[model samples]
Target: MRAGHLLLSRSSLSHLLLIFTLLSTFTAASFVRSRAPSPQRTAGAASRRDLISDTVENILHPVIHFAPTVLGISINNKGLQLDNGTNPNDPVQVSQALQTQPPPIDLGQLLQDITPNYNTSKTLDSACSAIHTALPNNDYVGRVCTTPECIQSTTHYYNARQAGNRPACVTYPTSSQDVVTIMKLLREYDVTYAIKAVGHSTGYNFTTALGFSSTTGILIDMSKMKAVSYDASTGIARWEPGQSWGELATTMAQYGAQVVGGRLGAVGPGLSFGGGISWYSGQVGFASDTTHAFEIVLADGTFIIATQDNQYSDLWWAAKVGMNSFGIITAVHSRTLPGTTTYGGSVIFPTDKMLDVLGAYANWINGGADKCKKGFVLPAITDFFVESLITRLNIFEFFFDGTDPGECFKDFNIINTLYDDRKVQPYPDFLNKALTNQQFVFSGFNNALYSSVTDLINKDQLLAIYNAWEEYSVQTSGAYLQNTLSFSVITKTGLAASQANGGNAMGVSGGDGYLWVCYAEGSIPAIGALMDTKLFGLTPQAAQAVPKSQRKLPLYANYARLEQKPFLTYGGIELLRQIKKKYDPDNFISSHTTGHDFY
Candidate 1:
């Protein structure tokens, strides 16, 4: 994490800048955190102060001194190198360093191993050949990886799929026209393909292989299609598929226009098309709720504009959380408003207050009057338990239009007061780097388990879940309960709009506010069963009286395991099937039928 620097006081800001410069002038703590052996997982494995101190001493300090003399490179606390002067030899040195460490995993090698033999099927062969012919000669899509690597590398799916298998080939679509062309290829070849934007699926559900399709068939990558156009006079934005929430925020900020997007900007626009939720979602509506129109490429290789006024409005409803069962979404036109400069940052709270903290969070989401208008949506989250000693409560707090820190102080103080030991830092600085700089055991993929309780916002339920999480993690050692809490006045919009297309299983009707409590943690084999059993497979049950109908479906695509029937959970099982038949009768996109079938 970047030093706890904010645009707060002059001294603090200056110290932050000085520290930033000093750290930059040196090149010591490589983003590698060294992990000590753990006996069993435990909460007291590493204290926050200890971790912070070690990060400064081991990583930051060395890079600070060694940088100018040996490497002649200046790196910021976040490890972004600043070039004082150009050195052609620097490329060779940097290349050697990267080669020594390499990225965590190789995407091509993993694909070749996990992919079925090249002789798998005619459909796969035909689809792969077509994809290979489509790519322009570029290192990004070199001769080795036909289509899969292009998607995997750019989308960072290799990072996500390490917990599972990687796709063999990835296909790039230059535009909505290209998307339709690829769909026709899939239909003619009778091959299955995965339609992905952002590729930030959370769990095993969305990314997992559902049908009998080989890896080489198709991995439809839309990263290149990221284009954003806005008409300030029209108060609307036409956003292309592969765009991320961060890109949207930065882009819109330039025009002083804002759309409801999430803190994790890298998690593409595909997420919003599937029922977008954001910190601002509570007041404005889920990201999808703000969507006015969608330019879609359906299974029949036909491109159509679908909206409330469009001819295919039924298909529009099903697209909310239908996964890829429908077709590819090329662009989304969403209502936009003036952007705000004033924003809130990520907050850290003491570990002892997890239950009370989350309970208070549940209460706040249910009753934080006028906060959403100012863009205050706090998604409570817990980050890595870096050695069983420290797990930071990472909260994504937002403010929409208000710039006065004084205006946001009440909310900030309320949350900070929850714990005597709290650290407040700007959101941008916090997310610009990894959690620790030690030789930490970095997992190939980070998985987040999430469930939303909308109608029944019970304090006891929140507390019970927290207590259960603590008890569970205490035994497991490596795992901890992380949460992201969002409550919105737009609950009615989500409920009404979810059924507008074809409806979904994300039971979010008549909810006062939405509470999405998620548990996100990462670990290596040294932690063993603690990472798998306690972290991976524990079902959280807080209130037995509450039915499952009140919960919003899980948000990120990868977080939902295949059996979760995510399409149904987000809206409804039956509606998903109907939309599947209507838009993609051939099921070109994945239809995860482990147990829950769309139709």
Candidate 2:
């Protein structure tokens, strides 16, 4: 069970060698290997020559001859010796032979020596083999993919940047027990890993394994755990993490109820953990605020239920916007609302109407639209250029909990639009429409996103931010495939609802309304780095354009880029840190897993 004491059997050796060959071939040509030393190996650095010699010595010390019997050769810690008439202890003869003969190679040590910071191929293979052996009869056992084709087949991600990461194995766990088993083995082997729910995350390494030695990583794909159930008596809806919000909505509609969830159908339950925004947020709160409980497996393989009033209540609060820093979530239980038909749809205006659209959005929020607590709107300015043809659009998506929004959306409705598809529709249908229309544009391109919150600004402030964004977009147009700046409001009523339902760790107060701004971009692989570098400055630039009085708000975790520190802006950092320490005392999850870091 220990990594250092691992001894491979003949069958295991063959498996290890096959994995080694595959990984070496896969990475040698396509990926750049990381040479960083592991935490344990960083302290007393050895010279390259000495490290190579020591590796050879370790390999040859545990001599494994192909034949059943040794051929008059004796290997030991000192050196290799030949027992052919010459004295076996003769130093000169042994030294000469050591210089001439090729030393035996220990596949395990060789792998370790090369991959100091990652689990060796032997260790990874052993872990995978153990998983297959432990869960032989489980349906998901067949889904433990190791070959390139199988890994590729199961490795689809919404962001192309994440798709490029190749884990040594991809595991599909159907239940908490399966996840517990995998977590135990991964910890035992000290392997780095990433978890995938729907893979809708934009940040690199957020849902996929990355780095030069990422071939040794493991990806725990939770897609097979899609199971949903409803309790009509209590109006509670329970589901596994594998399903999407769209699927959950459709299924819950059959029960005449719906859970607060993401607006996009393809986005999974992971959104709730990042403080999900939804069409219903204006009436209820964040999607996370509706969570009744969570069934999660900790880094030490302990499976427990986290609820607002349970022994793990702190974990419940942290999990709301924790962003995968605590553990792997298996299941979620949420409060359900009546599944009533809602009025919502998208309206697209021409580029020339940008000011009008901005003014409408500003007026709606600043003019007490949040007071209605039944309407939600997302306004975005998008610029798309293809084949040297540029197109600019002002798109607004409006929603209401009931059939009529009344004067809530009057300003937006009066704008002259290029395309208007507003209508009364079912909640699930509206989500499906948005998904079909919006998710297809950046299908194959690498993407990056940044998020910030500000006080509901006036028309002039919105215009200034828009102008800055437009200038940045035009300056970097040739570097990207598409760019968009979108805004969503977090109403005071919504924040009150969140506080009523066990306040989360997002650090927002109900004193006033605020706006969530998201800047997203997509580019080809060759320009992904350039796009990210430029995109990093966009949020700060826009913040500077607005007055300081209106810009000191928390960043939304779900929409934030990798480098942005949403946790730093949170008001409950000390409590969050204590909860993290109590739950993950050794910091194993944060150290071994790739996710948004809290510290």
Candidate 3:
């Protein structure tokens, strides 16, 4: 009985200790809670707790929970009252009692991120109704086939913006008046918009459609506005925006005329703003250099004409490389060359003499030996099958205006025959047989990284650079090295025509530089993965292969990657910023906020 009494006493002491611990915890919690407001008051305590819970919820589910302006919010359970520590009147806050709240999301920022696509069925229905009401009798106004089979007839390319998760829509403008109507609607809705011409741009800012992903915003399809013509007397041609280089080429060929345009035929004018290097660039200059005039539709739904001698010269300069940020170009007037029905083409070389062959060509180009100014000379090195397979290096060349092939061929033969292993075939038969099967050679625009050099490096320097490039090419999949190693005389024809009327942002500010173009060609597989170093599975990955000194931080506008340094590369970001302010102060007109667009 005495032992049992002692056990019972010990149990009572243990229970007392447990109660004491619970009381201490509750007292400490209450003291801390009381410091925020009158936490002793049950209503105040509940309100502070509610504020903390709401703050967390807002962060997690902002779209459904909060209004548009909220940027971000963080809640500190330590102090519940509008902690006077940060800015007050932040609308994102849950209560005046809380110390801090989320900052509001910028309206401009939201517009930049959001790209939405309208349901094709819904947009078609909307288009049909609008077209009928506007122009009842005109068959062309709403002429899209309305049959069940023709349901998804409109071309849609709104994928990238949708992936980034933005509001996007599409409007079909059947006429110039319809374009004005859409402009009015954009103003009324107070939303950002962009125009689409052939949907060719790969960059986030220029293109709206993603082939397999969700679309971001309203696409302004200008396919219906295709118009082209040429005047032989004045050597002038007018082209609408939506036409492809191939289409324009064929059309102009009928008029016995040719254009100095992009190298590939399929490239469109949408983001090939200003102009770009083309196959004919060797002779005439760049595509934009030949542009005589432009008809631009401004932000205010007004049309303005810019020509060689014009009141809106600044617009003309901006139009060359300004992209779609300023306005939509309805038509371009460009200088056209007298058509040549016959042209010279051939491949020159022998595999064993690659070093000598390349060196000879380089010397000729550098020394102006053959007077081959603005002439296209593309070289390719590939495997040749003989008794044993060996490397074959050769050049594919063409002279557009029917220059006598004898002199050029003699020059080529002089170096080639020295090695006693060279052969030459006529231009006509060679191109037909060699290039016949490779029809899709110019189908897509590959990512091309380039650098320019005016200070001619020595043969040793050239050999060193080539060795480094060849090593890089072998290491990386699908990388290629090609060069346009010519002189300034070739590009001197147009005489910096655009410079007289302001100047193109992309036009050569510093003239005469050697252009080295390195490109990666293949199907789009794992672009993001390729960029990330971790995926490469190496101690030093692809990024390390390209040194800071080797890399030209600036990029050529036409072939540049969207993620590449825009301001430093493009050389017009600040100028564009000031222009954006003057033309679009409210920032309602949004492109994908490129590095150039940011500053």
Instruction: Highest TM-score: give the candidate number.
Output: 2
lDDT of 3: 0.41
The predicted structure with the larger TM-score, 1 or 3, is 1
How much is the lDDT of residue 503 in candidate 1? 39
Candidate 1: segments with Cα more than 4 A from true spot: 1-119, 132-143, 146-155, 162-168, 203-216, 353-356, 369-373, 379-383, 394-400, 404-443, 452-454, 479-507, 525-533, 542-559, 570-576, 591-599
> Where is model 2 more than 4 Å wrong at Cα?
1-120, 137-154, 205-216, 435-441
> Which is the better candidate, 1 or 2, if ranked by lDDT?
2
Give TM-scores for every candidate, taking all chains together and pairing residue i with residue i: 0.68, 0.77, 0.59
Q: Write the per-residue lDDT of candidate 1 for residues 1-599, one digit (tens) a residue.
A: 00112113235444543443344322222222322233222243333112124545565564454443442322212222223342212322222232234233322232233221222455565566775665543223321344554535433541233323333356667788778777777777776555556555543433343321123335666778878889989888898877667666767776777776654545566567556666455355556767778788887889999886778877766665554556778888888756444444434444554455566555455555334344454444433333223233334344444445444334345544322221333332222221211111122333344443335366676555555554544444322212222233334443444345333345455445455544544432112222444444444453232456764434333344445444545535566567677676755555311122453
- The model with the greatest lDDT is 2
What pairs collide in candidate 2?
none
lDDT of 3 by residue, 296-405 (tens): 76677667778758887666666677666666678888887774443444343443455665565555444332244435444433211111111122334444444443
lDDT values for all models: 0.47, 0.66, 0.41
Write down the RMSD of all candidates, one decimal each.
13.2, 18.4, 23.2
